[model samples]
Structure formats: structure tokens, C-alpha cells
Target: PRVTAFSKQLEKFHVIIDSELAVKMLRDAPSPGKNWSAFLKVDCGNNRAGVWWKDEAGVDLAVLLQNSPNIDFAGVYVHCGNSYHTSSSEEVIQVLDDTIERLMTFVNHVRQRGVTCSTVGIGSTPTCRKPTDRMKSLTELHPGNYAFLDVQQWSLGSCTEEDIACCVATRVIGHYPRRNQMLIDCGFTGLTKQGYGEMASGYGVIRGHPNLKLCKMTQEIGFVESLEGKLDYSLFPVNSLLYILPWHSCATAAMHSVYYVVEGDTVVEEWRPTRGW
Candidate 1:
């Protein structure tokens, strides 16, 4: 239904297909005389969405798409999202190597069946950030998260803390000396509740203050306390700004419509990203 509704606009875009049903959908989509371009999404190891790379059905689907008159079989697309679960950079490379080998084998199988895949690609911020020589064999790489890296990417060794480009700025709203906790203006609604128990600093990392931890958050307020000693209210006065490095920048960025691009201490530009699908 989506393809039929956006047929005119989708002619300029390449869609992903993982099954014969999707191919049929595109073939019958209400766009006459339009040979829709599409990539066969192959599941190397992510197991999220895509036909398994080793499955014979995948090869058959590739051939079917290649032979179809109403569709243009562009290539194979793989999302190596498993790389994000690794403990270290070496493990990330291991997953990358395994995914590449499996994808290449699948591509070879399709080639043997007389289907020429021009663009064999794999993508994830972890693998793409640390490129290997084996990646040269592929034609394209799409690492969307690298643009605004988060604490998760840093944990995966994909980038350093300095490489993180975006953060949520909140202000100190209240102080509680008895409980050794302070409140911030941002909460799950503003910063999201994604990284609970993931980082040592709790929901998000408080920038430039290693001693501080964002222990909890409500709909519109965040509870912050010192990780070690007692909380010092003098250090964080009311109305003072506290920047938080989100564990997932994509989720945090979705909460706001306008992004204030800052250089040093100056607010240089404001970018209003396009919303909705």
C-alpha cells in the first residue's frame, strides 16, 4: 500500500525486499511503466529483517527479481547490526569479517544462477567506522549513525567520546541535599528512556562531570546525584545548564524538532530536520 501511495516519489529511491511477497507487491504496485529499483535484503547474522544468506530460497528470490520485467534488481543489502553487541573492536571486526564472507558466498551463489548483483553492501556504524581491507570488495557502505555518534557507538569502539557530535542540554531545576540528589528540567519526554542500566552514569552520561550520575528520570524531570561522595549543590546552581551525552543519539534527536549546532560556546546555526515517514 505504501509503494502504491508513494509510487511517483519512490521512482527516485531504491527499496529493500526480502521475500517473494515483497517482490510481488512492487510488481503489482499501481505504477504502470515504472520499473521499480530494489535491493535484496540479505540476513548475514543480524536476524532482524531479511532472507537468510545461506537459504536457497534467497538465491531463488534473487533470480526471480533479476528475471522480472517490472522490477530492477539493484543489488544485495546487509545490515551488520550484530557488530554493535561486541565487547571490543577485535570482536566487531570478527563479526564484520564473518558477515562479509557470508554475504560474498551468497552473492557468488546468485552469480552462479546467472544473476549479476552490481552493488553488494554491508552497513553498521561499528564495522564502517573501522574499515577493513576486505570491505574494498563491496561497492557501497551506509553508516547512518556515524553522523551523530552516541555513547553506544563509543562503547562499541566505533568512535571516541570526542567524536560524539550531539547532546541534550538541560538546566538544573531543584536541589535536595538530604537525599543527595538534584533535579534537571529534562526527562524521558525530552531525552528519552532508552539507556537505562546500560551506562554507569545511568540513563545518560553527564558531560564534563565524571562524579555526577543521572540516576533517574520522570516525565519532565531527571534526578541526578554524585556517583561517589555527597552531592554539591553549589557546583550546580539553579538555572545552570547541564549537557547529557545520550546513549542513543538517534532516539534523543527524535525528541526535538530543531537542532542547535554549536561551535565552542556559540550557537552558530539551527537545523530543523524533516519529520515523519
Candidate 2:
């Protein structure tokens, strides 16, 4: 309980500090050992959590902890979530390079002030997969999704499309003559229902469903329309199963209680991964 309830137990139940709330807790917290050892979070590039690197507040908070009696400033932490915005190899590389340079600069500056800043941590799946030498100064690497990478990881070149081992198989249910739509049995429930719809291949990009476009979806239906508007799909028989590539693979995985594993002409077994609280 000392470890799992908190995040930075990687250091053996280490009570790692995080957020402005954590920082405040440390300021008033009692010393447990030589010090209440903790890590400081700075918004190096990822704005999701931690103190802002540009806020002056983040740096100041770290400085404050170092001088506090109850807490031992173990080190600093950060993640470059903005790196996820990179749409290409070159852009991903540049974002990684620039992020490391900036974070390390903060660490170097902190040291010049006589504070014993140690752990200079940073992360982002893309940056880690394509590491840069600037990160040699870091104390720890915290990457969450390295275990089972997905489509987003594939698009960023973090992992290949083949490395993505998850998908959904939904069957065609009906063809609408009035709206020129093909209805699939999978809706938000079956296909892990999600999409940016506006994108060329939204509502889960179909692998070989080439001439097809998923226009919209309801709770138990997928509206598959033709992008060309003239191509004939009358050949696809009802009840034909369709394989789907999820928009947010991580989220889609959450909806399934069990996975039906299959091999050619054989039913392997049922595989179930754990889920939400």
C-alpha cells in the first residue's frame, strides 16, 4: 500500500512528490526517514501534469523542497507528451531534441544555484523509442505504454503496424437504400466505438476495406458509405465480418471483458486482460 497507491515507488516505496498538491503536502509533511524522499515534476514539454517548466513556479517549488526540513529533494521529473503531436519522423526527432535540450538546461541551471538536483527524468514513448544522447543526464525513465503499443504508436513510428496486436471484428448487419449506407453490427460497443469521422479513415480504419468509408456510427451500428460515391459494394453479403483498426486502441481495449483468440480453422481459447477500477 505504501507503494502502489502512489506513483514513484520505483525507488522502493519512495514517497515521490507530484503536482502542486504534492508539493504542498511535502511542505507540511513530516520527515519519515533521513528525509521524506521525493521527486519533483516539471512540465518539460508535456503540459498534462507537474509544475510548469516556464512557470517559474515549478523551478521555485523544486528549490523550496531542497531547503525544506521534512522533504529530501530526490530529483526532478517530466514527460514530453507534446511529442505525440509529431506527424512525421523528422518532426518527432526535432521535438525530442528540442525537449531534451530545454529540460537539461533547467537541471544545469538548478545545479548552478547550489541545490543538489539529481534525477532529471523525462519521457514520451516516441522519444524513448528514438532516444537522444542529451538524456544521458537523466536519473529515471518512466514510460507507461511500452508494454502493449497501439495504432497511435504506429502512426508516430514508435512501433510498426504489425506490432499492434489488437483489433475488433464486427459483422455487416444491413444495407440502407434510403441513405446509401451499409450498417455494421458493431457500434460504440463492438468496434470500441470511436472516430474523428472527418479524417479520411475514421470510425476505425479498415485494413482491406479499401473502397469503403465509415461516415458515422450509432450505439450498435456503423454507417459505411463509399468515398467515391459510385463504387458498388453490393457484393458484400450481410453478416460478413469486418476487421477494424481502432482510433484510440487503448480506450477500445477497455470495453472488452474477454478476447476471443483464434488460429486458422481453430478456436484457440479465451484471453482476458484486466481492466478499470
Candidate 3:
């Protein structure tokens, strides 16, 4: 197996066991060495991937993983993804506290069973960004989207517009004064069609053009409408360039193969991405 092959070379790696079946699978899969360990994933209300903290079955699985001689039980890990849906700082804090408490309670349960949990990891971009005082018990914080904050981050109150480091440059392609609509060259291909729930208006926000809304889109064309006053055609003349803050940076970046790294007006470098999954 790939894991068995890699374990032979790597110094250490922690496997995530979220269920009883996963524990059995890992136990059945022979290990080449003792360099690998396991992290019992706890579903601290995230409802995604992980064992429910309150489930007796989950705790029993954790104890099973801990008792396994071949695989070391490193600790517990939880991804508080529900924090992303938080609309206010209060909600963010609540999700973070609740998730952390649930994880700790589960950890205490495992520790009482005599398992030495070395790593207590928890993370979610929104929760990490606004962790009021919940960082006391966590040993590791893994916030992936902190690198390139997006409009969704801003909408979730996790960050401000100034915190967003990436934006898609789009060119005005067509104008229809009769319908009070303007078309841009960038659509789902360039600026992904992902939207921030309730907070975002359409596809993305036109940077510095607050009134202009990217209401509709096709493969290569984006329809922009004036949210407030009438759209000033002269202001955004055809061929003019506009920058759009994508709702989700990950989705937008995935659509492109190469990233044009820019610093001010200069094209500093070309960053190429890895091909395929």
C-alpha cells in the first residue's frame, strides 16, 4: 500500500481514524514500521468527517485505537467547519468554544482510560481568526484559507476587505444602456461563481465599484448591474479593466492553471500550479 510504502521512508505520520471500521482497517493493514501514529478525529458538531464526540461507539473506537500496539494514538483532531456559517463574532466564539469543549471533554474521557494524547488540534479559518480566548487548550491551529482571504471570509466577519490578498482582473467587454447592464470578460472560468451565503450579492464584488453587482454569468461573460443609482456607462467604458474579489478564493484559483503574482503594477512572477488531482 502507498501508506505502508511511505511509512518505510518517512520519520513519522499520524493517521486519522474517525470510525470503528477505520480502526479495524488500519489494524488489519500491516505496518512496515512504528513511525506512524493515529489521530482520533472527533466530530465536535461539524457533522462532516469524524466520530461524534457524544457517541459511545466513537469513544469506544478511540479507546480501541489507543490500546492498539502497532499504531500509537497521538491525540484528537476536530475541524470546526460550522464556524464558517457564523454571522457574528458571538456566533464564531460560541462555535469555537462549543467545539473545543466537546473535543476536550472527549479527550478527558480518553485520557482517563490511560491514553497519552500528545496533540490536541482544532482549526477552521473563521474560528481561528476570531478565537477570542479558546486557544488555551488547543496544541495546534490549522487555518488553511488564512493565506488568501476572500470575500466569504469578509462576509463571515472573519476578516476585512483589506485582508483579502487576491482578486481577479476582468475587462469590460460589452455595454447595454437600454437594459442598464454591462458585461465583463471574466465569468465562472476566471472568477468562480461561488457565492457567500446571505452576505454576498452575486458572483463576486467588483473591487472599488461598490454599486456594480455581478448579478449573472455564463461561461465567459458576467452581467453587472448597478445596485443603487443608474450605471454610468462612461465610467466603465468597454475595454476598461476591473478587479473582482471572488467569493471563494480556493474555487477561483482552482479554475486557473497559473497565478500571475503581482506587486503593485509590476508582474513580479509567474507561479505555476501542479497538474491533476
Clashes of each: 0, 0, 0
Range of the 10 consecutive residues with the lowest summed lDDT in candidate 3:
192-201
Model 2: per-residue lDDT, tens digit, 235-266?
Answer: 66788887777766667777788877667536
On residues 1-277, what C-alpha lDDT tens digit does candidate 3 reach at each position? 8878878887886688787777777777876676358898889998899988988777788788877767778888999999987779889989999998899889888888777888999978998988767688989988878888898889888889998988889899999989999999997888866883433457888889888888988899999999888999999989999999888888888888888888888899998888655
Candidate 1 lDDT, tens digit per residue, 1-277? 5555566665455789998998988777776447778899999999999999999999999999998777889999999999988899999999889999999999999999999899999889899988888998799998878889999998887888989998999999999998999999999988899988999899998999989999999999999999999988899999999999999998999999999999999999999999866
Best by TM-score: 1
By TM-score, the candidates rank as 1, 3, 2
* lDDT for each candidate structure: 0.90, 0.71, 0.85
Against the true structure, whose lDDT is highest?
1
CA-only RMSD, every prediction: 1.6, 4.4, 2.5
Structure candidate 3, residue pairs in collision: none
Candidates' TM-scores? 0.95, 0.73, 0.88
Q: Candidate 1 regions off by >4 Å?
A: none
Candidates, ranked, lDDT: 1, 3, 2
